[model samples]
Target: METFSSIECFVRSAEVGSFAEAARRLSLTPAAVGKSVAKLEARLGVRLFQRSTRSLTLTEAGQLFLREVGSSFNTIQNAVANLASAGGQPAGTLKVSMGTAFGRLFVVPLLGEFLRRYPAINPDWHFDNRQVDLIGQGFDAAIGGGFELPQGVVARKLTVAHRVLVASEGYLQNHAAITEPQDLAHHQGILIRSPQTGRVRSWQLTNRNREHSPLMLKARMTMSDSEADCAAAAQGLGIGLVSMPIAIPFLESGGLQRVLPDWYVDDGNISIYYAEHKLLPGKTRAFVDFIIEQFAEQGLAQRFSAV
Candidate 1:
Protein backbone atom coordinates (compact mmCIF):
# COMPACT_ATOMS: atom_id res chain seq x y z
CA MET A 1 0.00 0.00 0.00
CA GLU A 2 1.22 3.51 -0.83
CA THR A 3 1.44 6.05 1.96
CA PHE A 4 -0.75 9.14 1.57
CA SER A 5 2.10 11.47 2.55
CA SER A 6 4.37 10.12 -0.15
CA ILE A 7 1.59 10.35 -2.76
CA GLU A 8 0.84 13.94 -1.74
CA CYS A 9 4.49 14.94 -2.05
CA PHE A 10 4.81 13.28 -5.45
CA VAL A 11 1.68 15.04 -6.72
CA ARG A 12 2.95 18.42 -5.58
CA SER A 13 6.37 17.85 -7.13
CA ALA A 14 4.85 16.78 -10.44
CA GLU A 15 2.38 19.67 -10.52
CA VAL A 16 5.07 22.27 -9.77
CA GLY A 17 7.68 20.58 -12.02
CA SER A 18 10.35 20.81 -9.32
CA PHE A 19 11.14 19.35 -5.94
CA ALA A 20 12.20 22.72 -4.56
CA GLU A 21 8.83 24.27 -5.41
CA ALA A 22 6.95 21.35 -3.91
CA ALA A 23 9.11 21.58 -0.77
CA ARG A 24 8.43 25.29 -0.49
CA ARG A 25 4.68 24.68 -0.82
CA LEU A 26 4.69 21.85 1.71
CA SER A 27 6.91 23.68 4.21
CA LEU A 28 9.60 21.05 3.83
CA THR A 29 13.16 20.99 2.45
CA PRO A 30 14.15 19.93 -1.05
CA ALA A 31 16.04 16.98 0.37
CA ALA A 32 12.89 15.89 2.15
CA VAL A 33 10.86 16.00 -1.03
CA GLY A 34 13.56 14.00 -2.79
CA LYS A 35 13.57 11.46 0.02
CA SER A 36 9.81 11.06 -0.11
CA VAL A 37 9.91 10.46 -3.87
CA ALA A 38 12.72 7.98 -3.43
CA LYS A 39 10.76 6.15 -0.77
CA LEU A 40 7.69 6.01 -2.95
CA GLU A 41 9.76 4.72 -5.88
CA ALA A 42 11.30 2.05 -3.67
CA ARG A 43 7.89 0.92 -2.48
CA LEU A 44 6.48 0.77 -5.99
CA GLY A 45 9.69 -0.79 -7.37
CA VAL A 46 9.59 1.50 -10.39
CA ARG A 47 11.38 4.75 -11.18
CA LEU A 48 8.76 7.51 -11.27
CA PHE A 49 10.87 10.57 -12.08
CA GLN A 50 13.88 11.12 -14.27
CA ARG A 51 15.94 13.37 -12.02
CA SER A 52 18.31 15.74 -13.81
CA THR A 53 20.41 18.56 -12.50
CA ARG A 54 18.25 21.13 -14.31
CA SER A 55 14.86 19.48 -14.59
CA LEU A 56 12.48 16.81 -13.29
CA THR A 57 10.62 14.66 -15.79
CA LEU A 58 8.18 11.87 -15.11
CA THR A 59 9.21 8.43 -16.35
CA GLU A 60 6.77 6.38 -18.47
CA ALA A 61 5.78 4.36 -15.46
CA GLY A 62 5.61 7.47 -13.34
CA GLN A 63 3.40 9.24 -15.87
CA LEU A 64 0.99 6.32 -15.88
CA PHE A 65 0.98 6.18 -12.11
CA LEU A 66 0.34 9.91 -11.83
CA ARG A 67 -2.63 9.72 -14.17
CA GLU A 68 -4.12 6.98 -12.03
CA VAL A 69 -3.14 8.40 -8.66
CA GLY A 70 -3.73 12.07 -9.13
CA SER A 71 -7.52 11.65 -9.18
CA SER A 72 -7.38 9.52 -6.06
CA PHE A 73 -5.24 12.10 -4.27
CA ASN A 74 -7.65 14.84 -5.24
CA THR A 75 -10.51 12.72 -3.96
CA ILE A 76 -8.81 12.29 -0.59
CA GLN A 77 -8.15 16.01 -0.39
CA ASN A 78 -11.78 16.79 -1.13
CA ALA A 79 -12.90 14.26 1.42
CA VAL A 80 -10.84 16.00 4.03
CA ALA A 81 -12.31 19.31 3.02
CA ASN A 82 -15.82 17.95 3.27
CA LEU A 83 -15.16 16.70 6.79
CA ALA A 84 -13.63 20.01 7.86
CA SER A 85 -16.49 22.03 6.42
CA ALA A 86 -18.99 19.76 8.13
CA GLY A 87 -17.28 20.34 11.47
CA GLY A 88 -18.16 24.05 11.16
CA GLN A 89 -14.86 25.11 12.68
CA PRO A 90 -13.00 26.43 9.67
CA ALA A 91 -9.28 26.62 10.46
CA GLY A 92 -6.45 26.37 7.96
CA THR A 93 -4.28 28.33 5.57
CA LEU A 94 -6.04 29.58 2.45
CA LYS A 95 -3.98 30.67 -0.52
CA VAL A 96 -5.53 33.26 -2.86
CA SER A 97 -4.44 35.07 -6.03
CA MET A 98 -5.94 38.35 -7.23
CA GLY A 99 -5.35 41.38 -9.43
CA THR A 100 -3.39 44.18 -7.75
CA ALA A 101 -6.03 46.91 -8.07
CA PHE A 102 -9.08 44.96 -6.86
CA GLY A 103 -7.14 43.22 -4.11
CA ARG A 104 -5.89 46.55 -2.79
CA LEU A 105 -9.21 48.37 -2.99
CA PHE A 106 -11.58 45.62 -1.84
CA VAL A 107 -10.21 42.27 -0.63
CA VAL A 108 -7.29 43.46 1.51
CA PRO A 109 -9.37 45.87 3.58
CA LEU A 110 -11.96 43.24 4.53
CA LEU A 111 -9.34 40.67 5.52
CA GLY A 112 -9.24 41.93 9.07
CA GLU A 113 -12.94 41.36 9.54
CA PHE A 114 -12.60 37.82 8.17
CA LEU A 115 -9.79 37.13 10.59
CA ARG A 116 -11.84 38.51 13.42
CA ARG A 117 -14.66 36.15 12.54
CA TYR A 118 -12.46 33.12 12.07
CA PRO A 119 -9.34 33.70 14.08
CA ALA A 120 -8.06 30.21 13.38
CA ILE A 121 -7.92 30.74 9.63
CA ASN A 122 -4.85 32.36 8.08
CA PRO A 123 -4.79 33.79 4.57
CA ASP A 124 -1.86 33.93 2.19
CA TRP A 125 -2.52 36.31 -0.68
CA HIS A 126 -0.66 37.16 -3.87
CA PHE A 127 -1.56 40.20 -5.98
CA ASP A 128 -0.31 40.64 -9.52
CA ASN A 129 -1.52 41.74 -12.94
CA ARG A 130 -0.62 38.40 -14.50
CA GLN A 131 -3.02 35.49 -14.85
CA VAL A 132 -1.52 32.58 -12.92
CA ASP A 133 -2.04 28.82 -13.11
CA LEU A 134 -3.97 28.09 -9.95
CA ILE A 135 -3.25 24.35 -9.67
CA GLY A 136 0.34 24.55 -10.77
CA GLN A 137 1.00 27.44 -8.40
CA GLY A 138 -0.89 25.65 -5.59
CA PHE A 139 -3.25 28.53 -4.92
CA ASP A 140 -6.57 27.64 -3.27
CA ALA A 141 -8.52 30.14 -5.38
CA ALA A 142 -8.21 33.21 -7.59
CA ILE A 143 -10.22 36.44 -7.91
CA GLY A 144 -10.52 37.50 -11.51
CA GLY A 145 -12.29 40.16 -13.59
CA GLY A 146 -14.15 39.30 -16.81
CA PHE A 147 -16.05 36.09 -17.52
CA GLU A 148 -13.60 33.97 -19.45
CA LEU A 149 -11.94 31.30 -17.30
CA PRO A 150 -9.52 28.49 -17.98
CA GLN A 151 -11.04 25.09 -18.65
CA GLY A 152 -11.56 22.77 -15.65
CA VAL A 153 -11.84 25.55 -13.08
CA VAL A 154 -15.10 26.48 -11.31
CA ALA A 155 -15.99 30.15 -10.96
CA ARG A 156 -18.39 31.86 -8.57
CA LYS A 157 -19.50 35.38 -9.46
CA LEU A 158 -18.33 38.01 -6.98
CA THR A 159 -19.09 41.52 -8.27
CA VAL A 160 -20.05 43.39 -11.41
CA ALA A 161 -17.91 46.25 -12.70
CA HIS A 162 -18.69 48.67 -15.51
CA ARG A 163 -15.98 49.90 -17.78
CA VAL A 164 -16.10 53.66 -18.38
CA LEU A 165 -14.06 56.08 -20.46
CA VAL A 166 -12.74 58.72 -18.08
CA ALA A 167 -10.56 61.79 -18.48
CA SER A 168 -9.43 64.72 -16.36
CA GLU A 169 -11.32 67.99 -16.74
CA GLY A 170 -8.13 69.65 -17.93
CA TYR A 171 -7.53 67.10 -20.68
CA LEU A 172 -11.09 67.27 -21.97
CA GLN A 173 -11.07 71.07 -21.84
CA ASN A 174 -7.81 71.34 -23.79
CA HIS A 175 -8.69 68.72 -26.43
CA ALA A 176 -11.36 68.78 -29.17
CA ALA A 177 -14.95 68.74 -27.90
CA ILE A 178 -16.09 65.13 -27.32
CA THR A 179 -19.56 63.98 -28.34
CA GLU A 180 -19.28 60.40 -29.51
CA PRO A 181 -17.10 57.24 -29.25
CA GLN A 182 -15.51 58.13 -32.61
CA ASP A 183 -14.08 61.25 -30.98
CA LEU A 184 -11.77 58.98 -28.91
CA ALA A 185 -9.71 58.26 -32.03
CA HIS A 186 -8.69 61.93 -32.26
CA HIS A 187 -7.38 62.13 -28.68
CA GLN A 188 -4.56 60.49 -26.78
CA GLY A 189 -5.82 57.33 -25.11
CA ILE A 190 -4.37 55.21 -22.34
CA LEU A 191 -4.53 51.50 -23.08
CA ILE A 192 -4.49 48.59 -20.64
CA ARG A 193 -3.09 45.22 -21.70
CA SER A 194 -5.17 42.24 -20.66
CA PRO A 195 -3.11 40.07 -18.36
CA GLN A 196 -4.83 36.84 -19.35
CA THR A 197 -4.97 37.23 -23.11
CA GLY A 198 -1.89 39.43 -23.65
CA ARG A 199 -3.93 41.70 -25.91
CA VAL A 200 -4.87 45.36 -25.84
CA ARG A 201 -8.24 45.87 -24.14
CA SER A 202 -11.04 47.87 -25.76
CA TRP A 203 -13.97 49.59 -24.17
CA GLN A 204 -17.31 47.70 -24.60
CA LEU A 205 -19.86 50.48 -24.53
CA THR A 206 -23.65 50.18 -24.53
CA ASN A 207 -26.20 52.86 -25.40
CA ARG A 208 -29.15 53.93 -23.22
CA ASN A 209 -31.24 50.91 -24.25
CA ARG A 210 -28.14 48.66 -23.83
CA GLU A 211 -27.17 48.39 -27.52
CA HIS A 212 -23.41 47.79 -27.27
CA SER A 213 -20.26 47.92 -29.36
CA PRO A 214 -16.52 47.86 -28.78
CA LEU A 215 -15.21 51.43 -28.96
CA MET A 216 -11.69 51.12 -30.29
CA LEU A 217 -9.38 53.99 -29.38
CA LYS A 218 -5.95 54.87 -30.64
CA ALA A 219 -3.38 54.19 -27.95
CA ARG A 220 -0.88 56.95 -27.25
CA MET A 221 0.47 55.26 -24.12
CA THR A 222 0.05 51.75 -22.77
CA MET A 223 0.07 50.73 -19.12
CA SER A 224 -0.12 47.30 -17.48
CA ASP A 225 -1.47 48.56 -14.18
CA SER A 226 -5.11 49.72 -13.92
CA GLU A 227 -4.34 52.01 -10.99
CA ALA A 228 -1.56 53.67 -12.97
CA ASP A 229 -3.96 54.13 -15.87
CA CYS A 230 -6.41 55.87 -13.53
CA ALA A 231 -3.62 58.05 -12.14
CA ALA A 232 -2.48 59.04 -15.63
CA ALA A 233 -6.01 60.02 -16.57
CA ALA A 234 -6.28 62.04 -13.35
CA GLN A 235 -3.05 63.87 -14.23
CA GLY A 236 -4.57 64.87 -17.60
CA LEU A 237 -2.21 62.59 -19.50
CA GLY A 238 -4.95 60.88 -21.54
CA ILE A 239 -8.43 59.44 -21.54
CA GLY A 240 -8.61 55.94 -20.03
CA LEU A 241 -11.15 53.15 -19.92
CA VAL A 242 -11.20 51.90 -16.36
CA SER A 243 -13.33 49.73 -14.10
CA MET A 244 -16.01 51.54 -12.11
CA PRO A 245 -14.70 50.71 -8.63
CA ILE A 246 -11.24 51.99 -9.48
CA ALA A 247 -12.61 55.14 -11.16
CA ILE A 248 -15.23 55.89 -8.48
CA PRO A 249 -13.05 57.84 -6.05
CA PHE A 250 -11.62 60.00 -8.85
CA LEU A 251 -15.12 60.66 -10.25
CA GLU A 252 -16.36 61.67 -6.79
CA SER A 253 -13.33 63.93 -6.26
CA GLY A 254 -13.80 65.62 -9.65
CA GLY A 255 -10.34 64.43 -10.68
CA LEU A 256 -11.82 62.28 -13.42
CA GLN A 257 -15.05 62.67 -15.39
CA ARG A 258 -17.06 60.01 -17.20
CA VAL A 259 -17.18 60.78 -20.91
CA LEU A 260 -20.23 58.79 -22.12
CA PRO A 261 -22.90 58.97 -19.44
CA ASP A 262 -25.59 57.32 -21.55
CA TRP A 263 -23.29 54.54 -22.70
CA TYR A 264 -22.25 51.76 -20.28
CA VAL A 265 -19.71 48.98 -20.59
CA ASP A 266 -20.00 45.61 -18.98
CA ASP A 267 -16.74 44.38 -17.52
CA GLY A 268 -18.71 41.42 -16.25
CA ASN A 269 -18.98 40.25 -12.66
CA ILE A 270 -15.79 39.63 -10.72
CA SER A 271 -15.51 35.97 -9.77
CA ILE A 272 -13.83 33.78 -7.20
CA TYR A 273 -12.60 30.68 -9.03
CA TYR A 274 -11.17 27.43 -7.82
CA ALA A 275 -10.47 23.92 -9.01
CA GLU A 276 -13.64 21.93 -9.63
CA HIS A 277 -13.06 19.31 -7.00
CA LYS A 278 -15.34 17.90 -4.32
CA LEU A 279 -13.09 18.77 -1.42
CA LEU A 280 -12.49 22.40 -0.66
CA PRO A 281 -10.61 23.06 2.56
CA GLY A 282 -12.16 24.77 5.57
CA LYS A 283 -10.15 27.94 5.12
CA THR A 284 -11.04 28.32 1.44
CA ARG A 285 -14.75 27.92 2.06
CA ALA A 286 -14.70 30.41 4.92
CA PHE A 287 -12.80 33.02 2.94
CA VAL A 288 -15.15 32.66 -0.05
CA ASP A 289 -18.17 33.13 2.20
CA PHE A 290 -16.54 36.06 3.95
CA ILE A 291 -15.75 37.77 0.65
CA ILE A 292 -19.30 37.25 -0.54
CA GLU A 293 -20.66 38.83 2.62
CA GLN A 294 -18.25 41.74 2.47
CA PHE A 295 -19.12 42.55 -1.13
CA ALA A 296 -22.81 42.46 -0.19
CA GLU A 297 -22.38 44.95 2.61
CA GLN A 298 -20.27 47.14 0.34
CA GLY A 299 -23.16 47.43 -2.20
CA LEU A 300 -21.35 45.09 -4.60
CA ALA A 301 -23.63 42.30 -3.34
CA GLN A 302 -25.46 41.57 -6.57
CA ARG A 303 -22.24 40.53 -8.19
CA PHE A 304 -21.29 37.64 -5.89
CA SER A 305 -24.31 37.15 -3.64
CA ALA A 306 -25.47 34.01 -5.40
CA VAL A 307 -22.49 32.02 -4.15
Candidate 2:
Protein backbone atom coordinates (compact mmCIF):
# COMPACT_ATOMS: atom_id res chain seq x y z
CA MET A 1 0.00 0.00 0.00
CA GLU A 2 1.24 3.52 -0.77
CA THR A 3 0.22 4.71 2.70
CA PHE A 4 2.27 1.98 4.26
CA SER A 5 5.23 3.00 2.13
CA SER A 6 4.87 6.61 3.29
CA ILE A 7 4.86 5.51 6.92
CA GLU A 8 7.94 3.40 6.33
CA CYS A 9 9.76 6.35 4.81
CA PHE A 10 8.81 8.68 7.65
CA VAL A 11 9.76 6.22 10.38
CA ARG A 12 13.06 5.33 8.75
CA SER A 13 13.94 8.99 8.31
CA ALA A 14 13.24 9.69 11.95
CA GLU A 15 15.33 6.71 13.05
CA VAL A 16 18.42 7.44 11.00
CA GLY A 17 18.06 11.26 11.29
CA SER A 18 18.76 11.76 7.60
CA PHE A 19 16.82 11.21 4.40
CA ALA A 20 19.95 9.93 2.64
CA GLU A 21 20.76 7.41 5.34
CA ALA A 22 17.18 6.19 5.56
CA ALA A 23 17.06 5.99 1.77
CA ARG A 24 20.20 3.89 1.79
CA ARG A 25 18.68 1.50 4.30
CA LEU A 26 15.39 1.26 2.43
CA SER A 27 17.23 0.96 -0.93
CA LEU A 28 15.71 4.15 -2.28
CA THR A 29 17.26 7.34 -3.56
CA PRO A 30 17.44 10.29 -1.12
CA ALA A 31 15.11 12.29 -3.43
CA ALA A 32 12.50 9.55 -3.43
CA VAL A 33 12.61 9.16 0.36
CA GLY A 34 12.34 12.92 0.78
CA LYS A 35 9.35 13.02 -1.59
CA SER A 36 7.62 10.18 0.26
CA VAL A 37 8.12 12.05 3.53
CA ALA A 38 6.86 15.27 1.96
CA LYS A 39 3.80 13.43 0.65
CA LEU A 40 3.19 12.02 4.10
CA GLU A 41 3.50 15.47 5.74
CA ALA A 42 1.13 16.97 3.17
CA ARG A 43 -1.42 14.22 3.69
CA LEU A 44 -1.24 14.60 7.49
CA GLY A 45 -0.99 18.42 7.36
CA VAL A 46 1.84 18.41 9.89
CA ARG A 47 5.50 19.07 9.50
CA LEU A 48 7.29 15.95 10.71
CA PHE A 49 10.79 17.35 10.41
CA GLN A 50 12.66 20.60 11.04
CA ARG A 51 14.92 20.74 7.99
CA SER A 52 17.97 22.93 7.49
CA THR A 53 20.82 23.10 4.96
CA ARG A 54 23.04 20.71 6.94
CA SER A 55 20.91 18.41 9.13
CA LEU A 56 17.33 17.19 9.71
CA THR A 57 15.52 16.81 13.02
CA LEU A 58 12.02 15.62 13.89
CA THR A 59 9.35 18.13 14.87
CA GLU A 60 7.42 17.69 18.13
CA ALA A 61 4.60 15.90 16.38
CA GLY A 62 7.11 13.79 14.44
CA GLN A 63 8.76 12.66 17.67
CA LEU A 64 5.43 11.68 19.15
CA PHE A 65 4.29 9.90 16.00
CA LEU A 66 7.54 7.94 15.77
CA ARG A 67 7.24 6.82 19.37
CA GLU A 68 3.79 5.50 18.56
CA VAL A 69 4.45 4.01 15.13
CA GLY A 70 8.16 3.30 14.60
CA SER A 71 8.35 -0.12 16.23
CA SER A 72 5.06 -1.08 14.57
CA PHE A 73 6.55 -0.34 11.17
CA ASN A 74 9.29 -2.85 11.90
CA THR A 75 6.64 -5.43 12.71
CA ILE A 76 4.73 -4.71 9.51
CA GLN A 77 7.82 -5.02 7.36
CA ASN A 78 8.78 -8.35 8.92
CA ALA A 79 5.27 -9.72 8.53
CA VAL A 80 4.93 -8.69 4.91
CA ALA A 81 8.36 -9.95 3.92
CA ASN A 82 7.96 -13.23 5.75
CA LEU A 83 4.58 -13.76 4.13
CA ALA A 84 6.20 -13.43 0.72
CA SER A 85 9.02 -15.81 1.61
CA ALA A 86 9.00 -19.58 2.15
CA GLY A 87 7.76 -20.34 5.67
CA GLY A 88 6.89 -17.37 7.88
CA GLN A 89 9.58 -18.10 10.42
CA PRO A 90 10.28 -14.99 12.45
CA ALA A 91 13.89 -13.91 12.20
CA GLY A 92 15.87 -11.04 13.82
CA THR A 93 16.29 -9.83 17.37
CA LEU A 94 13.37 -9.94 19.81
CA LYS A 95 14.05 -7.44 22.59
CA VAL A 96 11.71 -8.29 25.45
CA SER A 97 11.44 -7.23 29.11
CA MET A 98 10.18 -9.41 32.00
CA GLY A 99 10.18 -9.80 35.75
CA THR A 100 13.28 -11.61 37.01
CA ALA A 101 11.79 -14.61 38.81
CA PHE A 102 8.64 -14.88 36.73
CA GLY A 103 10.70 -15.03 33.55
CA ARG A 104 13.00 -17.65 35.08
CA LEU A 105 10.18 -19.86 36.36
CA PHE A 106 7.71 -19.54 33.47
CA VAL A 107 9.67 -18.21 30.48
CA VAL A 108 13.35 -19.17 30.64
CA PRO A 109 12.61 -22.91 30.74
CA LEU A 110 10.72 -22.67 27.45
CA LEU A 111 13.45 -20.77 25.60
CA GLY A 112 14.96 -23.95 24.26
CA GLU A 113 11.74 -25.06 22.61
CA PHE A 114 11.02 -21.60 21.19
CA LEU A 115 14.50 -21.21 19.74
CA ARG A 116 14.33 -24.72 18.39
CA ARG A 117 11.17 -23.89 16.48
CA TYR A 118 12.51 -20.61 15.08
CA PRO A 119 16.26 -20.87 14.72
CA ALA A 120 16.49 -17.63 12.78
CA ILE A 121 15.14 -15.54 15.68
CA ASN A 122 17.60 -14.15 18.20
CA PRO A 123 16.20 -13.53 21.66
CA ASP A 124 17.33 -10.50 23.68
CA TRP A 125 15.77 -10.77 27.10
CA HIS A 126 15.96 -8.13 29.87
CA PHE A 127 14.99 -9.52 33.27
CA ASP A 128 14.15 -6.87 35.87
CA ASN A 129 11.48 -6.18 38.46
CA ARG A 130 10.92 -2.56 37.39
CA GLN A 131 8.98 -1.52 34.29
CA VAL A 132 10.87 -0.39 31.19
CA ASP A 133 9.75 2.05 28.47
CA LEU A 134 8.79 -0.13 25.51
CA ILE A 135 8.76 2.52 22.76
CA GLY A 136 11.40 4.91 24.07
CA GLN A 137 13.87 2.12 24.86
CA GLY A 138 13.44 0.32 21.52
CA PHE A 139 12.00 -2.83 23.10
CA ASP A 140 10.03 -5.12 20.81
CA ALA A 141 7.90 -6.63 23.58
CA ALA A 142 7.61 -7.16 27.33
CA ILE A 143 6.12 -9.69 29.84
CA GLY A 144 5.28 -8.91 33.45
CA GLY A 145 2.59 -7.65 35.83
CA GLY A 146 0.40 -4.59 35.26
CA PHE A 147 2.27 -1.54 33.90
CA GLU A 148 0.96 1.81 32.73
CA LEU A 149 0.44 1.35 29.00
CA PRO A 150 1.69 4.17 26.75
CA GLN A 151 -0.12 5.33 23.64
CA GLY A 152 -0.45 2.59 20.98
CA VAL A 153 0.73 -0.17 23.37
CA VAL A 154 -1.58 -3.09 24.17
CA ALA A 155 -1.51 -6.06 26.57
CA ARG A 156 -2.50 -9.75 26.55
CA LYS A 157 -2.94 -11.00 30.07
CA LEU A 158 -1.20 -14.22 31.07
CA THR A 159 -2.76 -14.70 34.55
CA VAL A 160 -4.04 -13.00 37.65
CA ALA A 161 -1.13 -11.98 39.94
CA HIS A 162 -2.88 -12.81 43.17
CA ARG A 163 -1.12 -11.95 46.42
CA VAL A 164 -1.34 -14.08 49.56
CA LEU A 165 0.05 -13.97 53.07
CA VAL A 166 2.90 -16.42 53.66
CA ALA A 167 5.29 -17.31 56.46
CA SER A 168 7.47 -20.16 57.70
CA GLU A 169 6.22 -22.75 60.19
CA GLY A 170 8.90 -21.72 62.68
CA TYR A 171 7.83 -18.08 62.57
CA LEU A 172 4.15 -18.93 62.92
CA GLN A 173 4.89 -21.29 65.78
CA ASN A 174 6.92 -18.62 67.68
CA HIS A 175 4.42 -15.80 67.04
CA ALA A 176 0.87 -15.35 68.34
CA ALA A 177 -1.87 -17.10 66.41
CA ILE A 178 -3.02 -15.06 63.39
CA THR A 179 -6.63 -16.20 63.16
CA GLU A 180 -7.86 -13.19 61.22
CA PRO A 181 -6.70 -10.15 59.15
CA GLN A 182 -6.55 -7.86 62.21
CA ASP A 183 -4.21 -10.27 63.98
CA LEU A 184 -1.38 -9.61 61.46
CA ALA A 185 -0.45 -6.42 63.34
CA HIS A 186 1.00 -8.50 66.21
CA HIS A 187 3.57 -10.26 63.92
CA GLN A 188 6.70 -8.90 62.29
CA GLY A 189 5.83 -7.98 58.69
CA ILE A 190 8.13 -8.62 55.74
CA LEU A 191 6.67 -6.09 53.30
CA ILE A 192 7.22 -5.02 49.70
CA ARG A 193 7.93 -1.48 48.54
CA SER A 194 6.54 -0.14 45.28
CA PRO A 195 9.04 -0.66 42.47
CA GLN A 196 7.84 2.40 40.56
CA THR A 197 7.11 4.90 43.31
CA GLY A 198 9.51 3.53 46.00
CA ARG A 199 6.72 3.91 48.56
CA VAL A 200 5.66 1.14 50.90
CA ARG A 201 2.06 0.40 49.94
CA SER A 202 -0.83 -0.45 52.29
CA TRP A 203 -3.74 -2.60 51.09
CA GLN A 204 -7.07 -4.13 52.09
CA LEU A 205 -7.13 -7.95 51.93
CA THR A 206 -10.25 -9.56 50.42
CA ASN A 207 -12.01 -12.86 51.11
CA ARG A 208 -14.46 -15.00 49.13
CA ASN A 209 -17.23 -13.27 51.06
CA ARG A 210 -16.34 -10.01 49.22
CA GLU A 211 -15.21 -8.25 52.40
CA HIS A 212 -12.39 -5.71 51.95
CA SER A 213 -10.60 -5.90 55.32
CA PRO A 214 -7.96 -3.30 56.07
CA LEU A 215 -4.44 -4.39 57.11
CA MET A 216 -2.49 -1.92 59.24
CA LEU A 217 0.83 -3.72 58.65
CA LYS A 218 4.18 -2.35 59.80
CA ALA A 219 7.20 -3.72 57.93
CA ARG A 220 10.08 -4.94 60.07
CA MET A 221 11.90 -5.94 56.90
CA THR A 222 11.08 -4.19 53.63
CA MET A 223 12.04 -5.30 50.13
CA SER A 224 11.38 -4.09 46.57
CA ASP A 225 11.48 -7.38 44.73
CA SER A 226 8.56 -9.81 45.11
CA GLU A 227 10.81 -12.89 45.37
CA ALA A 228 12.85 -11.23 48.10
CA ASP A 229 9.70 -10.71 50.13
CA CYS A 230 8.91 -14.42 49.81
CA ALA A 231 12.50 -15.29 50.68
CA ALA A 232 12.34 -13.19 53.83
CA ALA A 233 9.12 -14.92 54.82
CA ALA A 234 10.71 -18.34 54.17
CA GLN A 235 13.65 -17.31 56.37
CA GLY A 236 11.20 -16.69 59.23
CA LEU A 237 11.71 -12.91 59.17
CA GLY A 238 7.95 -12.26 59.26
CA ILE A 239 4.71 -12.64 57.38
CA GLY A 240 4.96 -11.43 53.77
CA LEU A 241 2.22 -10.39 51.39
CA VAL A 242 3.54 -11.73 48.09
CA SER A 243 2.40 -12.86 44.66
CA MET A 244 1.53 -16.57 44.54
CA PRO A 245 3.65 -17.41 41.50
CA ILE A 246 6.91 -16.51 43.26
CA ALA A 247 5.86 -18.37 46.40
CA ILE A 248 4.21 -21.39 44.71
CA PRO A 249 7.36 -23.56 44.72
CA PHE A 250 8.13 -22.75 48.35
CA LEU A 251 4.51 -23.47 49.28
CA GLU A 252 4.57 -26.85 47.50
CA SER A 253 7.94 -27.80 49.00
CA GLY A 254 6.66 -27.02 52.52
CA GLY A 255 9.26 -24.31 52.99
CA LEU A 256 6.44 -21.80 53.28
CA GLN A 257 2.81 -22.06 54.40
CA ARG A 258 -0.15 -19.82 53.75
CA VAL A 259 -0.89 -17.39 56.59
CA LEU A 260 -4.61 -16.68 56.95
CA PRO A 261 -5.36 -18.96 53.99
CA ASP A 262 -8.86 -17.48 53.62
CA TRP A 263 -7.73 -14.05 52.38
CA TYR A 264 -5.56 -12.53 49.62
CA VAL A 265 -4.81 -9.23 47.84
CA ASP A 266 -5.85 -9.10 44.19
CA ASP A 267 -2.90 -7.21 42.68
CA GLY A 268 -3.80 -7.62 38.99
CA ASN A 269 -3.06 -9.71 35.90
CA ILE A 270 0.37 -10.50 34.47
CA SER A 271 0.35 -9.60 30.79
CA ILE A 272 2.36 -9.74 27.57
CA TYR A 273 2.92 -6.18 26.19
CA TYR A 274 3.58 -5.03 22.65
CA ALA A 275 2.83 -2.21 20.22
CA GLU A 276 -0.66 -2.21 18.69
CA HIS A 277 -0.84 -2.33 14.91
CA LYS A 278 -2.75 -3.93 12.04
CA LEU A 279 0.12 -6.36 11.43
CA LEU A 280 2.71 -7.77 13.82
CA PRO A 281 5.91 -9.57 12.86
CA GLY A 282 5.88 -13.34 13.00
CA LYS A 283 8.54 -13.28 15.74
CA THR A 284 6.50 -11.05 18.05
CA ARG A 285 3.32 -12.94 17.24
CA ALA A 286 5.01 -16.30 17.77
CA PHE A 287 6.41 -15.32 21.15
CA VAL A 288 3.09 -13.86 22.32
CA ASP A 289 1.11 -16.95 21.23
CA PHE A 290 3.75 -19.32 22.53
CA ILE A 291 3.91 -17.70 25.98
CA ILE A 292 0.12 -17.56 26.35
CA GLU A 293 -0.34 -21.20 25.24
CA GLN A 294 2.47 -22.35 27.50
CA PHE A 295 0.94 -20.62 30.51
CA ALA A 296 -2.49 -22.19 29.85
CA GLU A 297 -0.95 -25.65 29.29
CA GLN A 298 0.91 -25.43 32.60
CA GLY A 299 -2.23 -24.31 34.50
CA LEU A 300 -0.35 -21.26 35.69
CA ALA A 301 -3.54 -19.24 36.26
CA GLN A 302 -4.66 -21.44 39.16
CA ARG A 303 -1.11 -21.85 40.40
CA PHE A 304 -0.65 -18.08 40.53
CA SER A 305 -3.97 -17.50 42.27
CA ALA A 306 -4.79 -17.51 45.98
CA VAL A 307 -8.18 -19.25 45.48
User: TM-scores for all candidates?
Assistant: 0.88, 0.80
> How far out, in Å, is residue 236 in model 1?
1.9
Clashing pairs in 2: none
- Predicted model with the maximum TM-score: 1
Evaluated against the true structure, the overall lDDT of model 1 is 0.80
What does the lDDT read for residue 217 in candidate 2? 67
State the lDDT at 113 in candidate 1: 85
How do the residues 17-53 of candidate 2 rate in per-residue lDDT, one tens digit apiece? Answer: 8899888867899999999999999998999999997
After superposition, which runs of candidate 2 have C-alpha atoms over 4 Å from their true positions?
1-87
Per-residue lDDT tens digits for candidate 1, residues 132-190, read 78877788889977746777688887766667788999998999988887777788889
Number of backbone collisions per candidate:
2, 0
